[model samples]
Target: MGEPSHEATTAPQEDLSSEATTTARGNHAEELTGAAAMFANDRASQHLGITVDDHGPGWAQCSMTITDIMANGHEITHGGYIFLFADTTFAMACNYPGSTTVASGGDIDFLKPTYVGDTLVARGKEIVKQGRSGIYDIEVTRGEEIVAVYRGRSRTLPARKPTTSDAAAPPVPTSP
Candidate 1:
C-alpha cells in the first residue's frame, strides 16, 4: 500500500491536553437521537485519545496518537483504529455548532498501514451544504505522509436541544 487516505481538514493543530473536557455535555450516548448517537459513536476514539479542534461551518481537525494498544500482533497499527481516527474527525466536524448530523455514506482511500508510535492526525473540512445535507473531505496523515483519506456525508436536523457552546463559531487555522 502507499499510505492510508484521510478525511481532509483545514484545522490548525494545537497542543492538546490529556485531560479531556466534556466535549459534548447535554446528551450522553443513551440520551441522543439516532443521528446524534451514530455521530457520537466516536466515544472510543475520544475515550482512548482523540482531540477535536472544530471551527464551525469551515473546518474541523482531530489528532490521535498510535500506541501499543493500537498495534496488531505483527506490530502494524490496526486499520480499525485508523478508521476510527478518521471517522471521529468527521463526527466533530459535522457536530460543530452542536447540531445533530448523521453521515449517510463515505468513500475512503487508504494509502498505507502505519505502525505504533506514529502520530496520526485526521482533519475534516466542509465541502458544501445544501438544504439539509453536507459533504466533507477528511484526511489522515502521519507527520507528513498521507496515510488515509475519507469523504463524509452528513444530514442535519433541527435542534431538539442544544449543547453547551452550541453556537460557537469555528476557530481559524493557525498551524499544526
Candidate 2:
C-alpha cells in the first residue's frame, strides 16, 4: 500500500469549509432543493461521518475520515466505504428540485489504499444529462493523490401522487 504524502501541508478541513460556504452562498436559490432535502434524511451517510461539503446543480463534493471501524482485514480503509462516498457525491450531483433521481448503475475502481486518519474527498460532476437519464463521474482523493474513480448512471423517476403510506410514515429524525 502506498503511504500518504506529507508534503501537502494544507488543512483539508479548512479548505472544505471555505469551499462549502462559497458554494452555499452562490447557490442559495437552490439550497432547499433536491440534495439538501435528501441528505437530511440520509442517516447512513451521516452515521459514517460523511459530510456534503458542497453541491450545485450538476456537481458535488463530499468528505469523510477513515476510522478504525472502517478498516478491512488488511488494515486499510475498505473499498466499500470509498464506493459509498463516491455514490453519495454522485447522488447529490444528479438530483434537483421536482426530480427524484436514482442510480441505475455504478462502477468504481480503487487505485490506492487508504488508512485510518486519512481524510478522503470525493468530487462528482455530471458528464451528460439528457431527459430523465444522466451520467456522472466521481473522483476520490486523499490529499493530492487520487484514490478511486467512480462512474454512475442515473434515472429520474416520474412524479406520482402521494399515497396513504407516505402520509402514515413518520418524519425522519434530524438527530439522535
Judging by lDDT against the true structure, name the best candidate: 2
RMSD of each: 10.0, 10.1
- Model 1: runs farther than 4 Å from truth? 1-24, 27-42, 161-176
As a whole number from 0 to 100, the lDDT of residue 73 in candidate 2 is 100
> How close is every model to the real structure, measured as TM-score?
0.65, 0.75
Instruction: Give a tens-digit lDDT track for model 2, residues 68-114.
Output: 99999999998899999899889888877546789999999999999
Q: Among these predicted structures, which one has the highest TM-score?
A: 2
The TM-score measured for candidate 1 stands at 0.65
Give candidate 2's total backbone clashes.
0
Q: Which residue pairs clash in candidate 2?
A: none
Candidate 2 Cα outliers beyond 4 Å, as residue runs: 1-31, 164-176
Q: Worst 10-residue stretch by lDDT in candidate 2?
A: 1-10
Cα-based lDDT at residue 123, candidate 2: 84
